[model samples]
Target: MKRESSLKRATTETDVSLALNIDGSGIARISTGVGFFDHMLTLFTKHGKFDLNIEASGDKADNHHAIEDIGILLGKAFYEALGDKAGINRYAFQFTPMDEALCRTCVDISGRGYLVFDVPLTREFIGDFETELLEEFFVAFTANSKMTLHIASLYGTNNHHIVEGIFKSLGRTLKTACAIEAGNTEIPSTKGIIE
Candidate 1:
C-alpha cells in the first residue's frame, strides 16, 4: 500500500494544492509566492526523502493566509496518507545542526493535536518572509494532522540557520515516525489503536 495523498484547499484568501508521498526518493516541486518558504519546504522534502508537490497562490499583499493555508493542506495530506497508522513506528526525534544553529524536533503520530515550538529568533524577518509566520505554519500543520510536535532551537544566532535546522530536523523526524517497522503489524499504541 502506497502512503500517498493529494489535497487542495480554496478560500477567499488563498488557493492551494499539495501532494505528498511518504515513501519516495527526495524530490520536490514547490511554487509558493513566498520565496523563503519555498526554500524551506524544498529542504524539508529533500531531507525527509519524501516526494512533495505544492502549488499555492494567495493575496501577496500579506503572506500570512497563503503560508497558513499551505500548512493546513500539507497536514491534511499527511493525515490522509497515514490511514490507520498501522505497522508504523509512530514516534521519532532528531537533532540537526547547521553552522551556529542547532535544533531538536520530535513527532508523535498520536490522535491529538499539539505543538510546542521554542525558538529564540532575534530577527523579525528573513528577506521577504516574516520569521513569526514559521510558528503559524507549524501550528496549522499540527492542528490538521493531529500530530504532537515539539521543535526547539537549542542555540542559534543566525535566524536563517536556526529555522533551517528546525525544518531539516522536522523532516528527518517525520520520516522516522512514518516508517513501517519490520514485524510490527499492529498499531504502535498499547491500546491497540492510534488516534
Candidate 2:
C-alpha cells in the first residue's frame, strides 16, 4: 500500500494541489506565483529528503493567502496520510545554518496546534513574498496538522538566509520525527497516544 496522501484545495483566490510521502527520497516538483517561496519549499523537501509535489496559483493582488493556504492543505494531507500515527517516531529537531544565519526547528505531532516562532527581524517582505507570511503559513500548518512546531532563527543578518535556514531545518526535523522506529509498533509517547 502507498503510505501517501494526495490532496487539493481551491478558493476563489487560489488553487492548490499536493502529494506527500511520509517516507521517501528527497525529491520535489513545486510551483507558485511567487518564485522565491517555491524555491524555499523545494529546498525544504529536498533537504528533508521528502518526495513532494505542489502546485498553486493565487491572486496576483496578494500572495499571502495562497502561501498560507498551501500550508494548511499540506498539513492536512500529512495528518490524513499518517492515519492513526502509530509506529512513528513522533518528535524531531534540527539546527541548520546558512551563511550567517542559524536556525533551529523542533516538532511534535501532539494533536495540539501550537507554533512558537522566534524570528525577529524588522523587514516584513522578502523579495516579493512577505516575511510575515512565513509565520502565517506555519501557524496554518500547525493547526491543520495538529502539531506543535517551534522555529527559531537565533542569528541572522540576511532575510533570505534566515528564512531558508528555518525552512530547511524544519524539513529535516520533520523527516526525522516521522520516521518509523524499528521494533516499535506503537506510538513514541509515554502517554500511549500522540493525540
Candidate 3:
C-alpha cells in the first residue's frame, strides 16, 4: 500500500492544499508566497526524501496565518498517511549542522500531541518571513499530527542557518521515526495500540 495523503483546508485567513508521500524520492513542488518559507519546506522535503506538493495563499500582508495553516494541513496529511502507526520505528532523534548553526530534533509518533521548541534568535524577520512564525507552525503541526516533537537550536549566530538546521534535523528525525522496522508487524508501543 502507498503511504500517501492529500488534504485541503480553507479558512478566512488562508487556503492550503497539500500532499505527502512518505516512501518516495526527494521531490517537492511548493509555493506559499513567502519565498523563505518555501525554501525551508523544500529543504524539509528533500532531506526527508519525501515527495511533497503544497499550494497555499493567504493574507500576504501578514504571513503568520498562511505559515501556520500550511503546517496544520501538512500535519494532517502525515497523520492520515501514517494510518495505524504499526511496524514503525516510532521514535527518532537527530542533530543537524548548517555552517555555524546546529539544531537537534527529536520526534515520537505517539498518539498524543506536544511540542517543545527552543530557538532563540535576535532577528525578527528573514526576508518576507517572520522568524517568530516558526514556532507557530510547529505548534500547529504537533497539535494536528498528534506527535511529540522537540526542536532546539543548540547554537547559532545566523538566523537563516539556525532555521535551516532545525528544518533539516526535523526532516531526518521524522523520516527515521516513520520508517517501518523490518519484520515488525506490531505497533511500537507497549500498550499494544499506539492510539
| CA lDDT scores, all candidates in order | 0.93, 0.87, 0.93
Tens-digit per-residue lDDT, 100-139, candidate 1: 9999999999989899999988888897789999999999
- For 74-104, candidate 3 gives per-residue lDDT tens digits of 8889998999988999999999999999999
Regions of model 2 farther than 4 Å from truth: none
Model 1 CA deviation exceeding 4 Å by range: none
Model 3 residue 133 CA deviation in Å: 0.3
Single out the weakest 10-residue window by summed lDDT for candidate 3: 186-195
Q: For model 2, how does the per-residue alpha-carbon lDDT over 148-181 read when each residue is reduced to its tens digit? A: 9999999999999999999899888988887777
Score candidate 1 by lDDT: 0.93
What global local distance difference test value does model 2 have? 0.87
Worst 10 residues of 1 by lDDT: 186-195
Give model 2 RMSD, 1 decimal: 1.3
TM-score for candidate 2, residues paired by index: 0.95
Q: Compared to the true structure, candidate 1 yields what TM-score?
A: 0.98
**Backbone clash tally for model 3?**
0
All candidates: TM-score: 0.98, 0.95, 0.98
